[model samples]
Target: MTGERDNNGVVGVGADLDSLFAEVEALRELASDSDKARDSARVYDFGIRWGALLSGRLQRLAHYHHRGELTPHEQARYEKLRTELRDVQPLAERLGIARPTIPLEDRR
Candidate 1:
């Protein structure tokens, strides 16, 4: 089912981001010519795209949350999304990827 696959995709994105983080940490000591270093760069790129998609979803969640129509549980879900946005925002910049802009209260 589409919903099932979407859930898998979300999990996959998180996995990729974790792998990228591991690669980045490994890169700190490895030289550029090393195999691990090369693989890390590739994985890091993949992570960036995944992060962008995830970021977009988080932004939409924030938008809906600010609309003030959701239930308490839904509001909590959006707050979690905001937390995710904050986490990935720095990673995007460190990876040299364009950061996603989440429209918040000041913009409305």
Candidate 2:
């Protein structure tokens, strides 16, 4: 759960998602600190890129789900991604960054 690889040297998707969520939270915190006046270009860039990657992955997952090819595990992953995107989108908007659009079919 700490995101370190296990004895098998394999990382779980949950760990990866946790790490990504931590990163987004860090960026959001930094961006929202009113007294710091930090340069936020890097944070914005990272958010945009991460959002794009999440959106693309969700799109593919939705396609598979629609085709009845997604496994239960994949459906769980899709829900996780969708939830993360929902959280991130609001932060992006608050930061004045362009949030990646989740397809209509993929929105919960």
Candidate 3:
């Protein structure tokens, strides 16, 4: 039962991340359109929403990491999340969106 539950959780996380990636790609396309003014309200709205979503995801990953002593697999998963968050931070900054601050403990 525990194994099933863990697999379900992993699947859910993968689905959520996939959805978020699609949203981010859509936002990127919108931002890159020649007709769209960068300073337009629509752009800012999307940027803000994307930033919030990314921030929430990072926080959840951090919470998961700190939940208990992680097995090797869990540690690897957490590292991947951290790397992804780092990769996205600069894009958020470029969009004039506030980037999430990853906790110092998670830096390791």
Q: Best candidate per lDDT, number?
A: 3
Distance from true position, residue 15, model 2, in Å?
12
| Per-candidate total of colliding backbone pairs | 0, 0, 0
C-alpha positional error of residue 90 in candidate 2 after TM-score superposition, expressed in Å: 1.5
The estimated TM-scores of all candidates read 0.44, 0.53, 0.57
Order of candidates by TM-score, top first?
3, 2, 1
Ranking by lDDT: 3, 2, 1
Q: 1-108 in candidate 1: lDDT tens per residue? A: 111224222223344344434534433334333464356676476566556554654444444445554456555544554555455555545545545466423343
lDDT of 2 by residue, 1-108 (tens): 122345533234444445555656665775677643245776567667666645654444555556555456655655675676577666667666655455533536
Question: Which has the higher TM-score value, candidate number 2 or candidate number 3?
Answer: 3
Write model 3 residue lDDT over 1-108, tens digit each, in one string: 111236434334454455555655665576567556366686688777777766776455555556643455655666765566566555556667666576533533
Clash count for candidate 2 is 0
Weakest 10 consecutive residues of candidate 1 by summed lDDT = 1-10
